[model samples]
Target: MIRFALILTSLLGLGITCQAADKQDLSLLTRTAEQFARRQLADSDAKITARKLDPNLSLPACDSLEAYLPPNGRLSGRSTVGVRCARDGWSINVTLDIQLFSQAVVASRAIRAGEVIQATDVQLQRVEIGQLPSPPLGSIDQALGKTPVVGIGQGIPLRADMLRAPAVIQPGQSVRILVNGDGFQVSGEGKALGQAALGQSVSIRTNNGQVVTGVVTGVGQVTVTP
Candidate 1:
């Protein structure tokens, strides 16, 4: 009976020892994985710049992320940490959410994307929006012409005498010019007459045997040079 008890105790001790060894091995593997991930995502040198996020409006949302990390980093397995934008010699407040994936793996090392990506995890890219430059203001003392310059600011009315035909006008072209009056005639040379469309300009021989220029306001009605 004493011999049997000793054998039983010895077996138990061996089983416990094996289990402990297995646990230790697993722990080592986990640590190694964590380190590998960090090495892959470590960014050493990075360059960032400012850009316009969207056109038609000036807002703080356009920025880019320039990061340089190790060649072996898997982005797909990680999560995005943060995004930063560099401006005015410092990083600005901007945020972006982007995801990355692992491209290749060799010798327990993973490569993600092309290069310079920090991690396979999702990251926020920061940006900043700036105001666009204003257009040059026109001179107030300049004479008000018949042709109304339609722009951002207010303007004048359509004068009849100020209307004149444009040179080198083509069909399907729309032109804006001042006519001397509401009634006008459109006539052009052989080729120009047939090709001219409404709102286009063409030269015409007037009834008084004078060569005049005018705009084609209608099918036959052209505003001539007064």
Candidate 2:
């Protein structure tokens, strides 16, 4: 009976040892996945959660595990990191949750649509770039002289597609027209017949009532080339 009890105790010790080894292996796998995520993300701040393998789950023993991102895998949001044995002996998908943050331009106060964005209208703020539908503007001055397509509330991040340059010439406004020829340049005043943004075409009626078309070059300015 004494001999049998000693054998049972020995077996229990071996079982615990095996469990500890398995746990360590799993921990190494998680750490590998996290390092892979950090390198791929390259963001200032990120929260990466690696898959949790069941302690009792049956898995093939792999001495060399490698982590990789699947083809076209997203860097953030819901995604997965694949871990496989270096010899293709076993593979598993380690799911991940990654959140990336960035600093971008945001409105400092309520901005009305069609109002030119001034220096005081925007400010830099932290935002989750991953969650946004489009990339936000990089700086506050990027929005200067631009008008929003729609009114934005205070603290809303600004996107490049959200703002447009205001019209440089308004209807019936006085404009300076520069006519360019091969060797001659002439400047005259005209009444703009329509509104136009910079680089757009507009019609102007000169002082002599002659109508001419030119490209809007700057505020209250247009240019016609021979």
Candidate 3:
């Protein structure tokens, strides 16, 4: 009787082990994670590496597995992927690393602050732009006529915040002013009291000495309405 009981217990344990192993396929989980990461960065060139789920980690037999990213998660470099069983409602996080690459505008040579960017100053290169806060400029045309707010190193990627827009109207410069009503148009001349970029507001001191705020519409021009 004792021998029979021991043999039955060993068989039952072996069966349970096999059943557990079949419950989850670790390889499938890793692949799901990789696919999810790739989709998130489909617009850019990215290479992803996902760590395999641990063999010893036990999960319920999931009928449908879905992968997701965490809120505010960084898409480049080391990141986490969350996988959930759609049917069972159990979720787990997996580790993943992504190397993001894109063709972006970079300084071909060192540029100084306040220097007007020329066609030869910037060029596009396929470079690793890991977790950039701002998207890099992708073309020389986008960088042309823009001056750096600060000195930038050669080969460094160019972003919007790094450059300042060329002011269309400078302080104390003569500016053509236009005043528009419901239908009719009026025009005058004023001295620009402040510097402004295109589409930015600037104070215009009219020839009559009354200051009016207007938007910079073009070089040496501001527009206002009475």
Candidate 4:
């Protein structure tokens, strides 16, 4: 009787060990599914849920340890039979794509594909949309064109040969001059001879035949001295 009781107890312990191993395998499957869902489907602030498939529906066959055992019938006892967990692992499979948007205003005008766009360009477009004021026209260079000419006096007769034509002057013109007994002075008036652009050098002849060279500064001004 004592030997029989001991044998029964040993069998019970073996059964408990087998049940624990099965539970561990099931837990592993659940964890793997969760990881897949987190990585593929709900990466953003979006929500995600999953469902397992039923075991009766085309479950994978689990391998039995007996297949590897010798014909002598010694049991290896390794088995692979299992229930289908969560769509058999299909619910965790997912794909994600992200899109971005800008808050900046765009031009109402038609935009060509592949054209590089900038903030200033967008602002100009917005002007057409009447979302913002029209950009100011005629940059400083344009304003300089409309500038008036300054006058030179004190009987300092301009040199006819050196007399840079007044037409050479434009708004905001300047020039350098070596005056009669006055040393060097830069002077010129509007457009440095009207409509003259910046950086153009012209010859100015003083009353005493002194030749001076200068750049247009304003509509009627030129710096001749320096």
Q: What lDDT score is found at residue 143 in candidate 3?
A: 89
Clashing pairs in 2: none
RMSD of 4: 24.7
Clashes of each: 22, 0, 0, 74
Question: lDDT (CA) for every model shown?
Answer: 0.34, 0.86, 0.90, 0.34
Q: Write the per-residue lDDT of candidate 4 for residues 135-173, one digit (tens) a residue.
A: 222122221212122332222111112112225553334
Return the number of clashes found in candidate 1: 22
Ranked by TM-score from best down, the candidates are 3, 2, 4, 1
Which regions of candidate 3 deviate over 4 angstroms? 1-17
Q: Which ten residues in a row have the lowest lDDT in candidate 4?
A: 124-133
Quote the lDDT for 62 in model 3: 74
Give the top-scoring candidate (TM-score). Answer: 3
* Model 1 regions more than 4 Å off: 19-24, 44-73, 76-226
Q: What's the distance in Å from true for residue 124, model 4?
A: 28
Off by over 4 Å in 2: 19-24, 54-56, 171-195, 199-216, 220-226
* Predicted structure 3: lDDT: 0.90
- Per-residue lDDT for 163-218 in model 3, tens only? 88899899999999999899988999999999999888999999999999999889
